[model samples]
Target chain A: METSAAGLEKAIKAIKIGLSLPEQDHLHRELEELLGWLEPLLAFNTGETEPLLFGHEAVNVLREDHPQEGRLAELQEAAPNFAGGFYLVPKIMD
Target chain B: MELRKTTVRQAADAVWKGEITAHQLIEKTLKNCSVLNEGLNIFTYLAGIDAVEQAKAVDQKIKNGEKPPLAGIPVAVKDDLCYGVLPTGLGSPAFSEFISPVTAAAVERLMEAGAVVIGKTNLDDMGQGSTTLSSPNGPTVNPWLAGRTAGSAGAAAVATGVCMLAVESDSGGALRQGASHCGVAGLRPTTGRVSRHGLNAHCSSFARVGITAFSGEDISEVLDLISGFDERDAATAVCREGISEIIKAPGSKDITIGYPVTAFDYLEPELREIFEQARERFAEGGYRIEEVDLGLLREGLLAYYVIAMAEAFSNHARFDGIRFGKTAEADSLEEMYEQSRAEILGREARRRSIFGAFLLSKDNYGRYYRQALKIWEMVRQEFETVFERCDLLMLPAARSLPRSLEGESGFLEGWSEDLYCAPVSLSGMPALTIPAGQVDQLPVGMQLVGPPFSEKMLLAVGSASGSTGK
Candidate 1:
């Protein structure tokens, strides 16, 4: 259950959460505590049980293919910046 | 003395009879809200002007001799809900300015039924914690006790008489635990029983839009209006007949209520005594009380955290800072995503998101995520077996009464406190928490859990307890 510093850094990077050195130390400690909390699940023999992806009894629910207008204008208005109904972000290409 | 003190049904009756105008009720509710917010911090956003206008419209309808079900009752929704008029912060700084263009289906149904939303109340940021502590505005203080966590701002608003009804959500017992702490009635319907169309997703599969109100009558009435199929939420099934009929009819006299003694080992002496007294009442009233074994359910705490964290990380990936809210000033897109999430997302959220990422990453996916899902299936099956012996299971809503908010470390402690209620969520069953009685001045509550889509039976049991109202 002990999460190494390297493993913690990989988790933060993979999750795209930027943590400062101090925050990283705090979170690393917290993660180790949380992993310790999760120890009970590791002891169970779960090989026979089927993994439940959905909690409900329903299978895949399909609707008819239909084109419908959405609230694009309202969504654009709420965004920080948008042009031609597309969300604006910082430059990704050089 | 305040009109806001009336329950939803009582106020709606008055509005229909012209005893009070909707506008007058909203004004009184706003006044009470101002007073309550001074010490309790009950609301994050008060719908002052819009509420008045909405009330006036209800008054106009009343003048024309039409009656709506909720008719001018003041209501508060949890801030995490996606209502368009007020900006949703989800208790996080990242969403402080986020305007939800779409309204939730349940909220829309309430408005259509003539309920006026007075404000949005605070919750743990993004509903991550059971306590209402993670909000940037700070935690909601319990009105019943000074130092104890007040539950959610929505629960506080109802208990403090600022709003007649409060709309709260539950993934892992947020609404029920809040109700238990605050001495109110909260009902979490079976998952997909109430449409999840307008709710902000945390653990999408586990989360359900529920409500907190003064009485089981109020909660059941709201459930009747909102619990049905929605085209927007494909998971919603066509509701079975007999909900209204069942609520009207008396619950079966020969009912067998299950008590899971093993699951409630953490309960304190005072709360345990109160629970025992209530159990004695049921036994004296000719009801069979069975002690059911919670085999797989004993591991509910670990399974809930694992599944919820994984789903939350996936659901929250939409908060890229480019879509809405304040974005970080950065040179590149990658830096923007990282800096924005890091800067705005709070400690609890960041911890969970990373934990989720770690659980789902590479070999860890099969090791943790899959294993938890299997345990989830086992928990559901165990509940199915338990239900075969009893009509419904009666349990405490919380392990202990509300704890002090002045503590140094509340994050880890809060997660552990959800043990009593998380098992219900893991099984996707219906549960209603009603204030059973009090231990001294503070209130203690008990939860009644039923099989899936058995809301009417649960509400009947709640009503029979005679604790849903003052």
Candidate 2:
């Protein structure tokens, strides 16, 4: 499938990214070339093969669920805006 | 001090025996790092006084009769790996001042083993590209040849002796290719062998914390210290079987190294010649070499990028400026996210994020994402079948020598450089790249890939046949 400007716009919206016209044009050409390069993947017959997610097949070890002290204060130090143990964000419902 | 000639074992031994104090070694290393950084741009951040203080503590520990395995050894950390004391830039300007609250498990283990961090090395934007040119801090110059890219700053640091070992991340062969470009040794351990708790996620399935050093011995030593099961990272559950037993170096005579003759066809003439010379060296050293067919090179490359991009999109979604990263001034939350991401991410990262969204879209999900996953399985199976006959697979580290810094290669052009390395990554096995030979005064590396949990065998073979290039 060819990557159209409309499709690119929809993708940009889906990812919540804002790009200028020039950036979009550059990305369009590059993404089209990359997608074209990936075309051979479609030719391979991968039938009967299971999709490998993680490289190793280790069963997840369950841990006892319990409340513990978190690094909220130290984490808040790296935040752009934090007050009263909460991260401050722009109003969404106003 | 001629730092280039020093090895991690020599430095650690000297410090342990009190032949040289940790402070003295650290001072020399800091001086070398400063002198080299100006010309080579090897470091994104240098520890300076902090490194000296850490070394002093190691010296005091030595006086107290405690012999740490990596006593007073200097290490260069790739910027992508979180080092709580320094900024974890991830190769973006927006993160130039962002400090991680927690240190990565790998780095913490290194420190506990007596490794002092010299500084954070440069990397590609968001660690997405093989070439280190996309970093906001400027390109890391090659130390071996003028006007050539280093491909990775960590490799250059090890090559220049600024650090004894460099802890770096490899998703699609950045560490291995960079080692090839800089004439050093790099080991990308089997996925989940090392904990990924503090690494800023790229491709969760393929990205692994790896080691780059002057010799396979150093890589092996550091690998043993860092590889273990971490409760914080569930992926590391694979290491519960004990890493020490799996890391014993075996004799070369006991190993059968396999080479894919068709894979060398993708390499340039000079690089192909270098690879042949490496195979001859191994054969001369009494190791058996055989021909193998890995027919899915091209398909593996495609599937790697598709899967990597899709996963990177999901991984980077959390960088929306509310809880982490620098926020952009906007009236609405959506605009804040869009503007912050646009300002924070570099061109290559943005391109990948957009492409990732497209690949994972409902219309293309099965056509691209799911198909790539299935191909990944096929690549893994091919390796499994090959390893049943051979103990290791030998391949070229990069398709060509380091590219010229004078010209910029396109995104697709950059992807071509990873042709040989990415397929091995899909196999989810450990691969070690060591300096095999040189062509036109530039170094070329050959990769020794092995089955999962076979790092010891790979490093032993690499050390036996590897060269430390001048």
Candidate 3:
């Protein structure tokens, strides 16, 4: 079950969005190094990883706004760059 | 006797028999620590005053005609475990000033059993590296030779002390590898043989509390006191009619030993020579030797890195410059985390944390962590096959002697030695390392491994090797 090239793109996009931090570049370099080492071992599996298994689909649903209020605010405060309910970043997306 | 070489058993017996007061014994041990510790860096902190107080209490207890198993026996505590009054770092700065609110169940159990918690010993930063160089305090060198321990300094913590024994923990090859370097005895107990309530896990699946000691008697006696099941550590099994029971089962002139059929290719000539001689000795001691395949031993390191790093990233996430020790000294919260990450974390720890985060990340979990565990299960099955034919497995503790500081090798070269020992850890089997001989001016060791809960068989084989004399 190798990974589909399309699926790998989606995963890369989703992951790139999540690696927000001051040390993102450090992490980026590390990711490249790690992938360089593990990607070969992974190629055989990626080839077998695709075509989707049962319960493998992601649901594009949003949660109900039931006042699950904001620990995210406090946690965000701990991050290096946040501005007015938004986490500042290198603007990966326009 | 000089404090550096005596076993804790002899000291404890003396303290118990009113032959020496606990304070005097502690003073001698502290003196030894102060002098030898310069070369070793074993103790992260030596509690002269605390040890004196503990000694006083033990002396009082002995006078009151009550004796506990480790009563008055001096033992060094690993710096990573919480010691009530001593500071613990888990090998990082985030928790550097964070003293324990309570003792870890394992240390408490050891103290209750009459062992004096002498001082905190050094460890790899965040328990992330195979070498103690990862420690922010500094690398703990092999006491027998002046360098970072071949696999890790886990030996420097306990065996370097003049005390009878010392406590240690293993998440991979921490105990076995360190003992191999120090040329002393070390035990990696069955995973649940003790408790982890107080210890930090780099990877929960492979972690276990262990002991490094002067002799097999010290190893078993200390383990007996700490090995029982604890409610706090859910993984510990009941005092099974299991492995410990077999250790006590007796009669041992003819035991079967399993040798690594391929470990020789990885071992240096000196170690290969020593291991071959050790096998001959084992055969002469009336044990049948069998060669077996454990390709799993090689995968053990890779799998261990994946598992340990993944868990470590989680365990360390709690120290996000919030709540505890010192603040991350950043103007903003995110800056705080970056600062915290940079300041207290070492090169190995940072590398491991990033790897851990990636392995456990939403995208990579299936490919890394999950597959690693499957490999571990296969290794366990491999162990099962081997044990059916042998009473214990014997192998060189490492590929070479304790390495030098400016090694002809790198940190990975240092960790590569643990390949033989770490698999035993991943399989959660009990193993011990004893000094086989010296190689090129440094001590080398041989490891004896047994099935889960097979401490008795491991030590019986170890004892027969005549490596246990104090």
Candidate 4:
């Protein structure tokens, strides 16, 4: 679900090239860490007296936890780009 | 009359008085839109069905003798801020083809108040630029001077005749500075002055949806209609409701005003002189003026760009190959991101992402982002401190005069001029820009920023200054 330093660097390098070098690995790593801490918080919220970021809101669970029917069939039927239950795309090389 | 030149209030009165039918208003409005929009490039998309349906409804209401606050008034909104009917793109090539499924709360409220939706306007690619030049379609030209900067020059030109009332959002000086350069009235109300639910995110801390109109009263009148608690937007502060009515302060007498001696140093010589004369004019009007020492905001644009861009890079991630915009054209999962990134981003959007990443990096966040935050805090503190000593603060709208087509502020220059205006916007204070008359036949506007949620107070002051004449 998350990237390590080398993996992030690889992704960053790839991203930079695709971005036409808008940024380099060094900058992405810095943003990655900050973003890792902030992704959930990047939205506007007012749960607190002051402006509450999305990350600050307490997570709530369903009052009555129960299994519901899944959208598996509908979701699967809609995927023209899928292969092996995953979205297919061109692979990149180092 | 087509009622094109009338203020929102004036147009609404004509409809209420049975002088103009809503359909006629819409017909004339579309004609104006087609005629004027070619040169200015203001609206991104005109809501043909929605506009007509809304107009027909307003006409029926009139037939029933019903009256609404914005009855039959045609208003235009910026593209990124959602209105439910049109495809909302924040000037990015990514979702340039996508339409919004839900309507923004702000748009919902304005429509409920009887405001006819004309269309969605243009903006900086990703709402990242201030001058409206960064748009992928083309910079929104000032209506008065062809090819003039809209955010900077269009603010005044829009007043001259682009749209009757324009809804422009501000992350930095996007509203007031544009309004200032355009020679119209722009107001960035305090945080929560209006709901940000349907707004495309820039930097939540620094961003706001502001209004532009010739009359300060029009901006505040619309502000009153849309400002309130929205159950959908958690950031919608419930502590304060909208200003009950525009404050009736005609002009200040014995009111102490702060003029930054040091900050004024940032002004180009011509801007400095124009500001000095406006300060003198205010003093002559029986108001007290004081030279408040605001530690000059040296690199505020850099700080603003870093802070806002970081927020945008993350916000824009949602457009990744799936939710909106173009899907990646690669064979595998990892390769998809690369292909999509190349196709989606514009020049400035890419530049903003790089700058945001660099400054928000661990090594630089403290040096750049945190330091910028500290400087901003200092500026806000100084504004508060000075306001305690003075009721209002006077300053110039921009650093240089209206830029010629040959002379653009460019990316760096554009980022820098926001220094003076960004502090006011970020602090979420009420800031207003009013024309101080043309200098060498080019317009120069002065700004009077006030305390939070005190737009009524600022509008009253700006109206007094603006009322002195063209």
Best by TM-score: 2
lDDT of every predicted structure (CA atoms): 0.81, 0.87, 0.67, 0.66
lDDT of 1 by residue, B1-470 (tens): 35435566777998999888899989988988888887888788888999999999999998888899999988898888888898787888778777799888888989999999899988887777778888788889999988888776777788887787888789888899888888888999887778888788778878889988877777877887887877788667545332332232334556888987776667777778888898888887667899999866558778888989888888878776776556799887888889888766687778888888888877578878999989999889989999899888988888777878886764667787888788889999889988888876778888989887777877777877747535
DockQ of 2: 0.72
DockQ of each: 0.65, 0.72, 0.06, 0.11
Residue runs of model 1 more than 4 Å from their true location after superposition: A1-3, A59-65, B1-5, B240-252
DockQ of 4: 0.11
lDDT of 2 by residue, B271-384 (tens): 788888878877888888889998988899889999989888888887788777788998888899999988877887888888899888877899899999999999999999
True contacts kept of each: 0.75, 0.83, 0.01, 0.09
TM accuracy, model 1: 0.96
Alpha-carbon lDDT of model 3:
0.67
Worst lDDT 10-window in candidate 2 chain A:
A1-10
**Clash list (residue pairs), candidate 1:** B104-B198
Interface RMSD for candidates 1 onward, in order: 2.3, 1.8, 11.2, 9.3
How many backbone clashes are present in model 3? 18
> What fraction of the true Cα-Cα contacts (under 8 Å, chains A to B) does candidate 4 also have?
0.09
Output the lDDT of residue B278, model 3: 82
Instruction: Highest lDDT: give the candidate number.
Output: 2
Q: After superposition on all CA atoms, what RMSD does each candidate show versus the true structure?
A: 2.1, 1.7, 7.9, 6.9
Q: Report the CAPRI category for model 1.
A: medium
The predicted structure with the larger lDDT, 1 or 3, is: 1
Q: Which stretches of candidate 3 lie over 4 Å from their true place?
A: A1-94, B3-5, B148-154, B157-159, B240-244, B248-254, B407-411, B466-470
